[model samples]
Target chain A: MMRAFFRVAWIVVKKDLTIEVRSLEILSTTIFFAVTVVLMFSFGLVVDGRPLNDVAAAILWVAIAFSGTLALGRTFERERHNDTLRALLLAPADRPALYVGKLAGILLLLALVELVLVPLVGLLFAAPIFVHGFHLVALLAGGTIGFTAVGTLFAAMLVRARSRDVLLPIMLYPMTVPVMIAGVRGTAALFQPTPDLAVAQFWIGLLGFFDVVFVTLALWTFDPVMTD
Target chain B: MHSDFETLAVIDVARHYGRRKALSHVNFTCAAGDIIGLLGPNGAGKSTLLNILATLLAASRGRVEYGGRTAEQAGADIRGRIGMLGHDLFLYPELTARENLVFFAQLYGLSGAHARVQAALDRAGLGDRADDFMSGFSRGMRQRVALERALLHAPRLLLLDEPFTGLDQASTKALVDRLRECQQAGCIVVLATHDLDIVDGVLSRAVFLQNGRQVGEPGPGTALRERYRQAMTT
Candidate 1:
């Protein structure tokens, strides 16, 4: 049973990746949005050609949150476009396994976006991202998991909804408040002059806890929410 | 992936959308090797009934059973035996015929997927077009491929909603032949369609539905389409 769950999850991941790699729709759009948001922030905040304190961290997390939302919506929209999700749900695969596969795909997509996003933030705001890169990765991984875990669930719940496009961000932003706060604080701590590792670690730990609780909740509820 | 299920029992199944009833106390049973037709008008809840049987939608009241087991009791395993070819066809336009079949085959964890997909492609007369993107395929071709995709697991219970919505004569004939093959294999086939003409030789018995309720079977010597029209009007 366990083996079947993992196998189904992996197959879904492969199918999603195959489609994404072919179209590059979500990847290109998400990257462009993130880059543009950071650039817009750079122009508005860096008024005197000197960066505002800790704004790079704030901007990076915001770009991720914003771009991540777009990616999630687009990913499920593709499923709804063809009603392939119905076929998938009709399959014998475990519901949580399907959720895991979708969550993984979104994570991989956002992670690619971040590869461009982090360096852009560092360059634009002179944040020391490279200096504490490892700790920063931990923070990003934790925060992203929390956000996408809840996101995959809600996006699925809304796949059949008439107003999914308008409702995604509205429903998502409020639920992800804790993730955003912890992510911003953790990365902001890393960009500081002394690099407060202890504080960053604490926030990362909190994000980790949030991921665990929400992932469990998402896995538990995905079947019920998706079954119409 | 031949299922051990011998019967699909739908008991007192009623479905409601808000205050409107889509199906009410609908009851039927299909045994293995039975090619049952669910005939009805546009608002007759044919598709709704098919969706419920496929486990894609829960009935507002009552339940569906596979081999005397409720879906809840059987869990996800019941789905393994249920194959559905819905209105959408469920084929990704971006993927090729081969890719689409292989993906679904893998999901079912079916071994020898390559051989099975090749056979399915050949069966659909799509062997040469296996690698070609489905975006370029015609509606008839896509329907054929989608039919094959749904049967990749050799599901014991096949629920098809308007499996012949749009098709050429050749495709329609091919689909009827395929349905017969499934019946020979002891697969319980339930189809909901408005193609009353094509179902002449295909349906062993048909259950007419109107306004979400099952109308009585045709009186002896009443033509199927005549019975269908009577069911719709009276």
Candidate 2:
């Protein structure tokens, strides 16, 4: 069962990567959007030391989360527009396995985008995020897993809706507040090099829990949503 | 693949979408190795009945049984043994034909998935195009790929909705030939199609569904078509 899960997961990731390589549109556009958001933040914040350090994690994650949602929303939108997702639904696999495959695809893309954005944002804001390095990456991954799981489920619904581009963030943001809060709070802890790992671990664990809960819910619900 | 599916039965199944009744008290049976053709006009619930049997949709009322096992109780087991091909080709446009098949093979949890996909490709006459990108393929070529994907898991029952849609005369002949091979291999094939020309000899039995009801007993030959024509005209 475990082998089956990862095999399906890997195939979905490969399919998304194949498309990304050919088009080169969604990836570049997402990165450009992220850079533009970073530049806007720089212009608005004025680069003062204390205020910059305090909210830097919040700005970084929020920007990544919203932009990542756009990329994911477009994932199924592209498939549905071309009627590709419908074909997939006809395949003789367990529906929940397909849900896992889709979640992995979106999560993989979000992770790849964030790897580039993290340091660029740190440089833009003159914050010390990269100082802790690996720990910060783990925190980012934890938050992203939860976000992508929920985001993919909602995106499948919005794919067929007329106002999907506008509806995705509106539907996803309110539900992901807990994830956003935990992401920022955990990242902030990692950056500061505090003696207490408890608080950071607590937030990261909360994000992890959210990941598990939403992933289960999404698997249970994705078939009905995808069919619609 | 089961050689004996005489026990597969659909009992008084009905389905509704909001206020509109799609399928009403549908009763049908397919004995082992039977190639059943479900024929009806648009909104006649041919697709709805097949979708319910494929376990993709639930019947509002009634039951389906395969080998005396209720589809509801045997949902997972039944799904594992069945393959479905709907209107959408469903291939990832960017992935090579090989990638697409392997992806579905993994989903079906097939052992030696790579080899099964290769065999399915050969069955669909797509072996030469295994590495080609599906996005650039012709409509007939894409449908072939979809057929290969559907056949990859060696399903005992095949549910194809309008499988002849984008095919040329030659391609359609090839598909019929492949259907014959599947029938010989003991796979129960069920399809819903508007193309009566192809159904004349291809179906073991053709069922006429008019306004969501099966008009009479389905049987072989021109009688099924006559009943279908009369029911639809009336």
Candidate 3:
């Protein structure tokens, strides 16, 4: 049973990856959007010769959150265009397996965006985020998991709604407050001149806990929420 | 191959959206080898009935039983055995015809899925275009691919709604031939369409619905168009 579940999930992942690889639509748009936002932030915030590093953590999280949402929307939007989500729902595989598969795909796209955004932010803002690279990676994983867990659930729920474009962020942002806070604080701690591993670990731990809670919730609720 | 005990019993099924009723007290029984045409005009609840049978939407007031088990009782196992092709193509336009079939076949847990996907592509007469992206296909090609996807699992019960929307004459004839093959294999087919000519010679029975009610059951002897026109007017 578990093997079948994974097999189905792998198929879904492969399908999404194949489309993404061919078009590069979601990845390119998301990365471009993130970099543009980061650029806007850099130019908008100039405080008396203060380095951008002071607020770089917040800036990075904002870029990720917004761009992640964009990626989630585009990812599910593809399904909506051809009613492929309906086809997916008709499949007899476990619905949670479907959710996990989509979550993995969205995570991969968001990771790519972050990979580019992190380096770009380092170069433009001179944040030195890579110096504490391990801590940064940990924070990114936790925050991303939490964000996409709930983001994926909502995105699926809203896929068929006529107002999905406006509804997605409206419904998503409020639910993800804890994730964003932990991400910003954890990243901020890592960015400090004298990095505080303890603070960073605590926030990362909180983000991890949130991810566990929401992923479980998402898996449990996906079937009911998606089915009529 | 189809199930020996193929039957679908929709008993007193009804669906409502707040104060508006989409379907009410709908009742029907379909068995294997039956090609049932669901004829209705606009707002006559044909799509809603098909959706209910597809398990995409739950009937608010009654139950649908497959092989003596309710959908809730049979669960995903039953769902796995039912194939559906609605008005939407239910395909990823970015994927090639072969890729789309393979993906759905895998989702259905078909063993030797790659070979089965190839077989389906061949059966759909899309072997030559299998590698081309669906985004560039004509409407008839997309319909053929959608039909192939639905048949990939060899489902015992097939539900199709407005499947002839975009097909040309040759594609439509190809679809009729495939559906005839399905019926011969003892697969129950419930086709919903407004055009009576499409299923005229193929349909084993016709059920006419109006305002969420099954107003008439026109058998093979009766001209379905006459029945449909009468049902809608009165």
Interface RMSD of each candidate, angstroms, one decimal: 0.9, 2.9, 0.8
List, residue by residue over A109-209, the lDDT tens digit for candidate 1.
Answer: 99999999999998889888889889999999999999999988989989989999899989999999999999999999999989999999999999999
**TM-score winner:** 1
Of models 1 and 3, which has the larger DockQ? Answer: 3
DockQ of 2: 0.43
lDDT tens digits, residues A1-228, model 3?
999888878888999999999999999999999999998888887455455555888889999999999999999999999889989999989989999999999999999999999987776676777778998999999999999999999999999899998999999999999999999999888888888899999998998899999999999999988878
lDDT of 2 by residue, A73-181 (tens): 7788778855666555655556677677777777776777787788876777666665667667778888888888888888877765899888888999899889989
Of models 2 and 3, which has the larger TM-score?
Answer: 3
The weakest ten consecutive residues by lDDT in model 3 chain B span B1-10
Chain A TM-scores for all candidates read: 0.98, 0.90, 0.97
Better of 1 and 2 by TM-score: 1
Q: What is each candidate's DockQ, to 2 decimals?
A: 0.80, 0.43, 0.83
lDDT of 2 at A206: 88
Model 2 misplaced regions, further than 4 Å = A47-55, A81-94, A157-167, A188-202, A219-228, B1-6, B216-225
Q: Second chain of candidate 2: TM-score?
A: 0.92
Residue B228 in candidate 2, Cα distance off native in Å: 2.2
Would candidate 3 be rated incorrect, acceptable, medium or high by CAPRI criteria? high
Q: Give the TM-score of candidate 1.
A: 0.97
TM-score of chain B of 3: 0.95
